[model samples]
Target: MSNPAVSNPAASSRRAARAAVAAPPPRPTSAQASPRPVAALSTRVPLGRRVAKKAFPPAVMLAVASLLVGTSVPANALFDPDAPPASMALSSIADAKVAETVEVEGQVIEAEAASDIATTAASRDAWTVTSYAEMLRLRYGSTNYSYNASGTGPIRWPFPFAAPVTSGFGDRVAPCRGCSSYHRGVDFDAGYGAPVGAIADGIVTAVGRSSSFGYRVEIEHIINGQKVMSLYAHLIDNSSVLTVGAPVVAGEIVGAVGDTGLSTGPHLHLEIHVDSVPVDPFAWLVANAG
Candidate 1:
């Protein structure tokens, strides 16, 4: 039985073939086996690129967050709820100053305007007065006028004693040594010591002596808003019963007619003035006497 294993070659060969198929592969020599497939350096490059790709986004995000924190503006600098901005505060002060300046300028302008208006009004008034004066000179041929209060309507006859007219008002040859070339008043031959009365309601303005007409009395009257003056001259000595500023009514006795300065005989010299200009007493009496 032991010799049977050695004596059959074909069987032995078959066993050998089976063992060879069942055995593991032999270790290779250094020269005979290809080097172990080395991982390529390029492959490591892809891995590095992948790692960088994953880390890069986080790094960029962190850097951006830091930049935002560093460059961020403070809320108080632009929009503070408790306090105004510096520029706004300065603007408010500037506006206040401008308003004050405007107010002052407006006041000055108003004052100047008021002054101009007053000046214009005064100039107009002066011109009116001058024109009125010129008109009186042209119409009356004289500038002597007077103001008086003659009752509401027409004037009254001046004499207390009825007398005829002795002399009329107008130009005439010199009647006496001291008489004017042009007669300015009318004369009534009332005889000596005749009672002289006021022509209208008036206040005595003057009581004095004159070289031309002795012992004169002047009374002022207003009639129809016009001023008038009455004159009584050549009065008797110590005959005046009224003083200056005394009120007198029409027909009230003022003095007595007599021969005084510049008179040829005993008479009453009467004159009328409109706004200081002498007018014809006879004409005035004829037109205005009640």
Candidate 2:
């Protein structure tokens, strides 16, 4: 009972080899397996990101911030430790400018004040001079001098010198040839150059050279509402300074005594007139010259 296909051993062996060639390979173990190589990790960073990471230094950053904000940094802040800060230096400069401005303003004010003072002083001086001139003008009367005697009160002495009365007014022998038989005025034995003064406030009516009176000055006054005249005669040559129409006050010097003309010696001849009538001058002097 053997089959024909089973009888050949070589054919059987060849079929076995063909079957082995067609079969799948077996899987490898963990230790014997090969690992795939990972792609090399990239180490290079981007240029833009690298530059952004490197920050600026602190000092440079501060300077840049100041420039951007329009703030100034003093040069000394970097170079000099002893120098003032920027704010302090700015403040000092401002203060100096203000001081200079104040000084200039003060100078201007002082100059103006000085000018005003000078002007005021000049004006005051001018006013003073004008007032003094007016006073002088009012005291001296014009030509045709006349005075109203009403309301006038007492008077002063007529002569500045004190001396004895050598001759009395009224009936007296003539001292010189061609002189009058009656005397009209009293005589005082004052040495030459003795000062004579006005007895009362009055206006000078006459000043002249006369043959009988020599150099004489006449002043008309008002006394107790009555008009009167005072006469000073026998004055030294050129000694009379009064002029007609001038004003005179009591105790004001008019002339000096002399022996000119009909005078017997160096003496002063004083006369008083009431309404142009000669009167005793001694009685009037004693009554008023207390």
Candidate 3:
């Protein structure tokens, strides 16, 4: 109903009323809030593996491989090139024109004694090497000396061979390995059954079969008013050419050569003795004849 507006003072003002709307929505998380501190989580297995690799390195395997290779080498391979040379040393004989005699292989190599041209008389006292038990002394003329100074002797074969050597004198040979016993004779490597003649005129003294010397024969001769004896060893079997009392001349065939006793091969072992003492046959040959 319409009511009449009366007296106007207070007026009931009539206005249109509108519905209230909400503000805009906020974000899902707070944008301006302080962040929280995170807790630390340790990974120990990877760190331990790294530390083990550093402590026991792959280089240890390489070192072990090198040591194994070094131990496998042989010891003898180190010094095989240092062995001694095999060639033997021998003393050389030069042109010995001036010297009366010289030593070769511990025996005297001598020439003939000086002869007087006026009467052809020979001087027996020329040169010799003293053969003794302890030492060897070389004597030249009347003067005696040693090898290191100067000396001489007769030409003698040092080694044994198969031949006819007339003079049997001083041959230095060891009967035993350590003992210094000489072969008091010159051996002739004359073939078996070859004729062994007398080197000088001598009388047969002993002829018999011996255990050490086989069929042996002894001859006694005179030289420069001195008695010299000759011994023949290892004669031909059963071939008798002389009796014990028979006299033989130089170069007279007396026996045959054979290998009978204390011999390695077929040869004639001849020995010459002065007053029953052994002397170098080569020296004797030079002194008696040129």
Candidate 4:
């Protein structure tokens, strides 16, 4: 193989060139070797991005991780720097020990009782959400409205306290624009949503809404060997007892005080009819109720 190629000068030169092209260069020593550039970056690239792309030393990376952990600990409770891939929720609740307070053993500590129940009149009313003196004075001149008299019957007043009466039965100056001058019922200025109870134990005769009465309930009872009909008007529409023949006992909450009919404000318009004749409730309740 060498005989013809070695002898010819042109062929020899061609063989030497081929050998140089085919053979790899000698390996460089550690001293001779130079570090390679990571990438060729443009000046237009963001400084932060360029820095992020470049490799960092172990100490610098460790410092960065430490800073992240310190800052994120408060913001993220589950953050963990030691565990692989950082912190995440544990697989099971049994992985962590329960707190002494959370898992109570024995001897439960009871809370302290309230100190004092009594307070100032204004504070007491504010706390209980009850107000009346001012409203009564402005509406009916004084706070007293004359429902305080007691009688010895199975009947009970609608309100537990002495409620203010705005108008009496018979005749009065029209209270509202469309109100009747000849008033037939007694208006009790019980506060809004105040419970209205049945006057006596009786059977409900009527339960409906009308323009004249506006959400009223009528009950029939035999009082003192006389047929007395009691009508509770200006009541909230959602009355508890709706059945006609429902037997109601005295002092049971039948309806709530409201402003539904031809009225001015929240009150209960109670009308008592003795043998179909309208009578003054004040005179009757004073005479009958004990």
Q: Specify the highest-lDDT model's number.
A: 1
Per-residue lDDT tens digits of candidate 2, residues 95-128? Answer: 5555565577555555455455545554665663
Question: Clashes per prediction?
Answer: 12, 1, 18, 4
lDDT of 3 by residue, 102-212 (tens): 333332423222112211322233555645532421221222211120112222221222244532343343543442245576666657787766656778998878776
lDDT of 3: 0.57
Model 4: lDDT to the true structure? 0.73
Better of 1 and 3 by lDDT: 1
Please rank every candidate by TM-score, starting with the best. Answer: 4, 1, 2, 3
Runs in model 2 with CA error above 4 Å? 1-154
**Selected candidate, larger lDDT, 1 vs 4:** 1
**What is the Cα-based lDDT of residue 260 in candidate 2?**
78
Alpha carbon lDDT of each predicted model: 0.76, 0.74, 0.57, 0.73
How much is 226 displaced in model 2, in angstroms? 0.9
- Quick one: best TM-score, which candidate? 4
> Which regions of candidate 4 fall more than 4 Å away from where they truly are?
1-144, 149-153
Instruction: Give the residue spans of candidate 1 off by over 4 A.
Output: 1-154, 160-162
Candidate numbers sorted by lDDT from highest down: 1, 2, 4, 3
